[model samples]
Target: MEVLALLCIVSVAFTGLTRGAGLLPDGPLNAAVGEEVMFTTTLAPTEIPFISVAWTFGDKPIITSNVENLTEPEYEGRITFFTSTGYLQLRNLSFNDSGEYRVTIVPRGEQQKTGTTRLDIYAPVSNVVVASNTTDLAEFNSTVRLSCSSSGSSLSVLWLNGSSEVTESDRVQLTDGNFTLTILNVSRFDQGPFRCHVFNPVSNGTSDPVNLSISLSVSNVVVASNTTDLAEFNSTVRLSCSSSGSSLSVLWLNGSSEVTESDRVQLTDGNFTLTILNVSRFDQGPFRCHVFNPVSNGTSDPVNLSISYGPENINLTKSPSQEYFEEGTDISLICSAVSRPAALFYWFLNGDKLSDTGSELRLMNIQISHSGNYSCQAFNPRTLRDETSQPSVVSVLERISGSSVTPSTNLPIEGKSVNLSCEAAGSGSRMWMKDGSYLILADNIALYDNNRVLSFRPLTKTDSGEYSCNISNPVSSDGASYNMVVNYGPENVQIAGPSEIRVGETLTLTCSAESTPSARYNWTLDGAEIHNSSVFTKDNTGLSDSSNYTCHAMNNITGRTSSAVHELSVTAIPAQTSGCSAGCIAGIVVACVVVCAAAAAAGGGYYIYTRKKRAKSTGDEGQDNTAYSGSQELNYADLMSFQSKDGVTVQLGSQNNSSKDARDRVDNSRPATSSPPTYDVHMQRMRSAAQPDANGAQIYAQIRNS
Candidate 1:
């Protein structure tokens, strides 16, 4: 927008300058040599889509539509004309290109409009040089003529004594449009160090200064140094000046201020050499030597002295705030120093050199071994000096992991010592919990190993619960739980059942015992094994199913067993006494023995037998035989049932001759193997097989318990 606005302003100004002549004003548009100039015309949008356009410089055509070779040969590659807006750009401008430009635009259905602009070119002022007729002039005795010259057209010259313009005066005279300056009746004040400033319409130029002094011309005033390698406060150096002149006095300067002699600074060799015994950093300067004799003086070019300094005031800082960092984290430490030529940094850990050689030391994925006192030493390679910073302690801690509570015995026995220790891979505090609550220590519960281990001395059944151990540090926390169970006895063993029931009713005897692991149950009837489960059931009970049923419970861990006894009896209903007028009713006690013989088949034959031993029946043989008089009594037990693999249960009935007498007790044991062995067996403790007779009837055989 700024560039377009400038073009618009130039167009408006050109239009105003040529409003009367119906011509275009191209320049008095000032442009520098080798630069381009633009001619802009404020032409309204063509109402009729004009096609006829032409441009000319004076009488010769420069460019025209549908015309070949019409552009002047000199302006072939340097001119561009936009027929639509009547704009023109002339490049690589020279003085010979100054002329009048004409553009004619012919719009459709309208007559042609002609715009004319005049161009004038000027050269840039350059190479301005001011000179004196004679440089050797006494300040109070000789006069000087200073002339200025430059290369440019329509140029003006201005003489300057320092920054003030040298105007016409009685002592200073200017001629040829101030191109000539004459300083007459010269004095020390008239010894002018002057300049010539020349400029034209295009550009301006200034000449280097020229000085006129008295006595002799001081030339080649150079400052030489004894040595450039000077250390701060450690080496002595000298700065001397040499120039060709006679009767010249010497002056010295450090930067803009003059250097004077003092205790450390000495002037030797006729004040030409400025020496200092101790070359401090401040003494190294852009020093200059000036030689003058009352009216003229020459100073050499600035010569700077280089001095090496120190690596001092070393400092080191750490991040992230230098607090405890967890393993696998990162930290950075930076070392800094105030020194000349930038100090070289060397990092150290516990007074040992590190491989890192920069200003910063970054420890990534830090571990426990990375934690230590860290310091930084800055070395001045030039001064051969080193300074160390105060050691910064960096602490990296291990993260809490693998935290768990391990019991000395996962399942400890009751009334025994047990220790629950909390362990982790990292350093952290340990805490113990019971179930989900903080454990309250009692006489039996205590802590050891800095509370890492929990001791439960003489553990009881109450100690069986869920316990958790939590280990934690500033970085992380973890916990593990242990479900504890204390082994105890099968105490308070008991059995519940009806003491008497009908012969066809069910006699259910359930036995239980208090123990950590469930106790194994055994049911016995009249000292014979009746069942081996917690609940013993006998359906269709008979008179023979009467006697002591004992339950034995045991804990494998405690190696202890306890038993309880239950006596149950089954009785038969008496037959109705309908013998009224039917005299002499006989009380018949008939005993039909049904013997249970072991049987086995290749495809799982069923056998029902009781393990009642005959020894028990022999002891009560007299009572059993007397109670059922006139009938033979057999007090033999039998296996009454067996279950096949297909879940088919076969029940066998045994008719035993029983007597209601305390002395008539029988003892049964576990079933024994049958006499004949079968090839394919499905029973865990199968018995021998008993073959059938010729009439396809089963033969009876007794199985005595061992």
Candidate 2:
């Protein structure tokens, strides 16, 4: 007994040692970046001061305890341990240090034991920003710059446009981490908001986006002329620049650089003035007035300088205020302007500049395409800038036949009225002119109806005309002549049939028109020749043989026609079945016949016996058969009765009779076809199939009959 007790205690101790290994004292260890943490173990007296202190990440030892080498790039300054202290310390922790660190102690001949600690590092995110110049509307092509930046350690910067990151190009420049975005030459295409974001491994943050708009503004310096128009090669030009304020320091650039003195170019008090000794095409180009002002350091819109060439005294004479041009006819525009240096001659249609040797712009053979907003800009070398006249709208009028003006081409009854209107191609404003000349006072036409509207109220034949509508404004005038045909037909015409009717009875058709002078009515069947069908005669009545009718009305003077169509139906009684041929005798015969019918009722009793055998042999059960116990038989009887009353006999055969019956012809003449042979056959089949034969007698009967 004493030996057994000692053995049991030993066994218990072995069990605990095997099961509880590495369970306690193995919890996860944690630390953060740039911080020092240590793990320690005990040592015996006289233990070598150089005892191994193994360093590792997870299960892999980055530095073996036996190597004793400390000056490695990855672990050099990041880790350290004292010989006597029996402690391991990690310094300046980084992201790579975020893992398990373990050390093994192997004091001479003793079993080795191990312990672990984990290191974690956290670093903050970098910064970002978006930048653009602050202004709208710059010159067509020029240089501009945008920039982005961030503030963080070991930083990286990214540039974003909307949602995508953009790369740098020759015209687009980017800096190191500074993220400077440059647009070499700015145009309308380079307008948008830019965003900047800042992030690092530790944390992330972003900056607000900078919105930019670009536009065009006159440069600091420009040349102008006191005279209305500039002449070619000979004109006095005045040069000017900002005398003070923001653009005061702006320097003038001629062509591409600062304007210095040439024989023809002179500057008085820094006001740029250029005198062309001889006016020629070589001097015509864009002149630059560059401003070096610190406040407005960027480039300004360049001023274009040109020489004048066009007909002189370019005056336009138009009657009917705004004259409508007709193609293939002669029309003229007299351009005239006085000049110290007589202007060269050219002609233009619309804004299209045309060249001519003489002073007048004449179209000997005009065309429809020539119609447009026409204006003239004149310039000469003596004048600094060109002058442009107000635009004149020239319409090439070509009248074609079959052009009619009505309030509407298609209109709903009672929804539209006959209002004759003028379709004139000119400014939409209207004014009155008597016959051909002199303006009519505003009072002559009703204020509500002032816009060339000829309303026909109870319209008469005299309303038609060649009336003219004249439109004018201070700048121009126009006129339109129209032949107003006051046309209207029967409106709100109703042809109602009699409400009460007997089968094959006739109904009267009354055609009434709610129109002026009561439009004349003509009746027709379908869409055939019309007939008056005298009012006293009952010719428009609805009869059994009559087709659908239509009533048309026409206005005699206006010659406008309108019609309404209506379906005429005669009433008749539906056919009901007479009593069955033999009354109750037939019904009794049908019932008796059903009692002896062949039945194909389901074999639930057999299904139950078979199911039981299957369940017993398989050692399982699915369900018990329950049939023909309640309403099933009644359902079978009801189905037979319905088939009897409807005279439908259902029969069973090798080939389904249902498929064959579906191909039978349908009787269109009679509402119902002749009755099938008898309902007795269907009833007999139902009754005979309802009974069960224990010996399969029905199968034997079918075989014998076949």
Minimal lDDT window, size 10, model 1:
582-591
Which is the leading candidate under lDDT?
A: 1
lDDT of each: 0.71, 0.48
Q: Compared with the true structure, what per-residue lDDT tens digits does model 2 show for residues 163-270?
A: 667578767677755467766655555655566655554545666666545444434344443332344556544445442223234455646756655666666654
> Against the true structure, candidate 1 has what lDDT?
0.71
Tens-digit lDDT track of model 1 for 1-706: 6577557545654565563234355345676668888877666443334566787877888777633325667777998876556677899988767877777766554466677766778788888999888876765567889989999888998888889888888888889888999987676565567899998877899999998765655678998888877887679988889997656899898888888889999998899888988676667788999898744679998887777767767888988874688988888999998888798899889999999889999999998899899999987777777789999998788878887788898669888899988888988778888989998888899999988989989898898999898888777889998899989978899888799886546789999999989888887766788788999987767778778888989888878889998878787644222221211111100001222122343143333222222222223322322322332222322234444345565443323433321112222342332222122221212222222232212112211110
State every prediction's TM-score relative to the real structure.
0.31, 0.25
Q: After best superposition, candidate 2 residue 442: deviation in angstroms?
A: 27
Model 1 residue 472 CA deviation in Å: 1.8
